[model samples]
Target: MKAMKRSTLATLINATLFSAVAGTSFSTLAEEAQAKSNQLEVIQITARKRVENAQEVPVSVSALQGDNLDAYSSAGMDIRFMNAKIPSLSVESSFGRTFPRFYVRGLGNTDFDLNASQPVSLVVDEVVQENPILKGFPVFDIARIEVLRGPQGTLFGRNTPAGLVKFDSVKPSQEFDGYAAVSYGSNSSIDFEGAAGTGLTDKISTRVSVLVQDKPDYIDVKAPGFEKEDSLGGYNEMAARVQFLYEGDDFTGLLNYHVRDLDGRPIAFRANLIEKGSNNINPLYDNDVVYHDAASRSTQEVDTQGLSLKLEWDLKEHTITSISGWESAEIYSRADVDGGYGNDFAPTMGPGFIPFSSETADAIPEHDQYTQELRLSSNFTGDFNYQVGLFLFEEDLTIESYSFDTGTYDEAAGNYGLQNGYAVQEQETSAWALFGSFDYSVSEQLDVTLGLRYSDDEKDFYAKRTDNPTPWNGSPDFLEGRANPSDSHVSWDLSATYKLTDDVNLFGRLANGFRAPSVQGRILFGDVVTVAESETTNSIEFGVKSDVLDGQGRVNATVFYFQMDDQQLTAVGGGSNFNRLINADKTTGYGFELDTEWVLTDELNATFNLSYNKTELEDDTLAVAVCAQCTVTDPTYTIQGPNGPEARAILDGNSLPHAPEWISNATLRYTKELEGGEFFVYTDLSYRSEIDFFLYESIEFKGEALFEAGVRAGYAWNSGDNDYEVSAFVRNLFDEQVVIGGVDFNNNTGMLNEERFVGAEFKVKFF
Candidate 1:
């Protein structure tokens, strides 16, 4: 792929800006300015456990209010709505409907293992979600979502080496209010969501919310005996939240409950590609092939439940607060490999060969987790604020895996038998931490913050296997191992912000952070059990935030450098077998992030976010290949693999997988209110620079650009005190077919990428 020309990049940026300006008028802008000035209000909260301006939190944070989400979703967008809209944030899920990986400033987990730990932590209403499955829960009825970039280990002391995302739902109010919306779209898609709340008394209130969304699969199943597309994907999500709040003269109490049940077809995995010029077949049709014989064709069900409580007391000079929460989830799934059975015998040998039929190599796993956190925060009378917290977490996971080779069974030779083996594995881990932070105002124009945290973690693993089934598979059938390693360490961060002017601020941060050691499943398959060492990172950043153009626009920009010691990474090797996790000797990353929002006119708004990242392995010795000369023994030495027989020769100095060097997005929105209702038009474009998907980086895959445009036209009516709206919208108007990810993992026989589809929708709202 060739590098993009400077002129082309500039053209795209300018076009985006022009489109936004084209949608508004001067008269409308004047009216909007006057209206906003009259309605402007201040938002105060405890971002640092004290009342302060949202902009003075001393952190890189972005917040989206519930009304903003309602407007975006009404325009046919979901939580993914914020992708590219925020700097230093990107989200991508696997080929299946599993948990999505979120990257912040080029730091994230890339391993596909089920038990892998993520560098970024997610907190919903002060409740920590430990299971990866629960991380994918849909976002709804939220008061606001805050994305805090950079390490937050001092306040959120779990696995926040990268950053933290917090979601605060709309709690119960002492007033009667509710919202309901229903939408129907193409592909048999239907979405119904509603939330209602009422005050039982002057001091008590309750709220309930629910969501149901369903859609047909995109692929067409064509097997001889199956009625539906065997490889298509779909999802069903149901969730609810209830909250209670009580306020007294000196004390405030709040409690809430949340539950979610998700059942969906994981992302469908295509095993092989249809040959070129093969009758122009539909790409959505499944071919009878399996990559690892471990693939499955089934839906997974994940159930999550949690509870949270908070209490606050107003003292004479300071406020006292206590927060506690617990969350747990269970997941079950059955995958089907080999969409169809085929003849196992050599085609040239004979006609009596029978195709093996089996559902082996499938997996069923379950996990449980519990967490507790206690924190106290207060503000001193003279320009000082402080917070201290303690956290504890534990999790247990179990998996039962089976493999069967259902071909011609030779009774005499156990090796050529019809069955292979059954395996059972279990893993358990626990973690605890204590943290504190303080912020002080050194002068009228300068502010500073300092924070520190200490943590300890432990893990244990047990596994057992049987080649044949028998009652004698007893207590000794399992091998147990424990990793009781503990680290008593401290992490600290310091930041100083200076108010250069009334509308501008300059800030710089120096932070030391660490990621806990991760258990490597690959070690369980080898002769020695080795634990990957913890990773430590030092980051230095400087940035400016300003409200410019007479308060009509806001821009935030930052440049940072990160040095990581013993970075954890997963390296791919022969035949889908690889290291789950290992500590790279050294890795360095540097990047710049810029985000701006401009209210160009009353009817028009524009937002753009861009990120530039460059990461490189700093050590040369660790990149050396293990089998540099064993051509016959190394299965990945084929002509299609990196360097052919010289495969191992090309294993050094490559960019990490999935870490693109450049990514950007721009959006333009225009809204016009008429006598009947309102009309909204939005257009967004995203671009990602070329990325190397493999460890060796010999195979080059070009990045893609995508454009999504939408329009919402509606009519609303006010009947008595109730309101109603009817609207129609379309998404992906251009219908661009962009590839999300490409892989050539198995013998170069298959290529897979996410497909594009256009959708039209109708929505009705009653309030």
Candidate 2:
């Protein structure tokens, strides 16, 4: 009976799709084809702070819709996983997924400091997330994701010397629509998410979304002191969002609230990755770590909440929009610092030598952020259009560090007598910007755009320390200081686009961007206070967007060159673990990117994306620390006279860290019509050339060329207005052991990428 029912259902779905397409009249089908011959599917974007067709925009931008975005994010709960699908983008996290750092086009910060600022900006719903911790909020229930290459200074302001990533959520709509995608994979990993929305009144609507991910441990525990089984590398995360919308005769308003909770173990690091001279991994190792002193298990939790309100009013010839937002979060992470058993270090530190077990705990117990923006835009149907806006932001952040005690050291005074007097620091930041953009269509085939922004930024920092043997409280004896630094700058961009034909556009753009001044005051452990002046970048870019093959294929390509002055870099000096900020004289780079999408036939589609970047520090005097994780690689090379036999792993003319020479992503999809449903197969491959993890490249901290692939086969059906799908998928199809990052601080610690997983997924949609 069950088999009969399944057969009947399949027939119903096949008939529905077949009739829907075959029932069309021959003349009507021909007319539809003619209408689509010279036009590609229109994709709308807000890259210019206003609604515009992506093809008509004169910027180098890539966008992915919600359905396609899920394909990338489904592999992991963190946003960093999307790097595989997007060219010109790379991400790595030293503190785990909650602190992912993003790099675009060879521009990014390699600092592990909590207060470090990134060149790339992450904007969600028009609100900027300045803190690195806040940027890790998982991405779910999104409307679209956009990546803008090069400097986005005029619109986004500071910390965007590289580019910007934008995420827009699906807003509340009058019609009810929602979907759920659930999957169960290897290691008992489960993923489930869903959203639904409906009208509450003639002019009001609401939407609610939730996401949950749970996974069990996969790594085994094999150590003398720890006897637990299956107790590492696991996670559970939950997130939800609510949105409300109201529309009146001349006004529209949207209110949204979101919350997230995460509990998990971050990425694991393997010790003894390499020795002193060479940059290769030691062969006498397995995929596991020894933890006789500790359980080799890390604990981390992050809680985040946010609220935003958006209001828009229509005037006779202009429109006004306002956005106000508030966000708060508390995060804590604790882990074994040494990444292995401590027995080997007993003879190095003398009579005080403990078993070498060490652990560090970091917390952001208090954090709050608020922002407001207002804009006025031209709404007239004319050749000239403009938008002027004001933006304000304020934030208070605090960070604390703790080290645990091990019996081999002082029990009363704490671990190595260094646990109690660790560190405590706080910072308050406020910023504002005034920006405007003008657009004019000079003629039917030519257009010009100009934008300018003036931004002001300020930061206040406070820090204190104590030397008491016990847990030290805030004391006056410890080095204490406060600093208030402020900076202001002007950024601008100019662009011109010429329509080569009805189906192609050629454009060029020149832009400038800046990063605000930075201050590091982790003075509790060390008495170092470092400050960096603002960094700026000037870019020149040219691009072309075209639709060919009778609208069956679309292509976008861009070439860009940029020069940055006073590039802020982090240097760990004075033989301490603390890092300081320094400014390099100059750095320059050039890059090119290409994206193409083709529909080979009625049933097959293909896409390809590629990017290449090269960058170098021009300042000959700049020498960066080498072998940060592994103290030994190429020890003999430090005997040069350039800086008096200094150990410099990163020197002048070295390509920027985390900058891969080549990155490419390709996808192929095929679909076939069935009786009551459709069957489809999809596959994708991503390749990245070798990448360095630190400014001073070390043999042990660089990843060789790696390729990752995934494949999925699915069946889809339609019942009335609802649709359903069942699919089986395999991630990391070849089980490639790609090393995404490394840790050289303690005996060559290395972090590996995700392992292979096979799973089945079910999805349903209704409208």
Cα-based lDDT for every prediction: 0.59, 0.76
Badly placed stretches (over 4 Å) of model 2 are 1-40, 275-292, 347-358, 406-421, 467-477, 572-575, 628-650
For candidate 2, write residues 642-673 as lDDT tens digits: 22454554356667878886889998888899
Clashes of 2: 11
Model 2: C-alpha RMSD to truth?
A: 10.1
| Count of clashes, each model | 8, 11
Candidate 1, residue 702: lDDT: 30
**Model 1 C-alpha lDDT per residue in residues 1-767, reported as the tens digit of each score:** 12334864564345334323322332234446543422112334445545466545566666665334554554223345555455677666542444666677767775555566777787888777765666766677777777777777677764677777777887888777877777776666777777888778888888888777776555555433333533455667777888888877888888988888877765444332222222122254332222222232455677778777888888856666777776766665544332333335423211112132233332335666777766777757788977787878888876665545534454754533244546565778888888888888999899999998888887777655544322232323234444544455578899988886666677888887777777654322222234678887788887766655545666666677777788776654333233445677777776677666777777787777777776667655554233211122212333343233423433334556566677786767677777755666666666666554445543223334444454455555556656776766655555544434423332212223333334444443334
lDDT of 1: 0.59
For model 1, give the 10-residue run with minimal summed lDDT.
348-357
- Models 1 onward score TM values of 0.81, 0.89
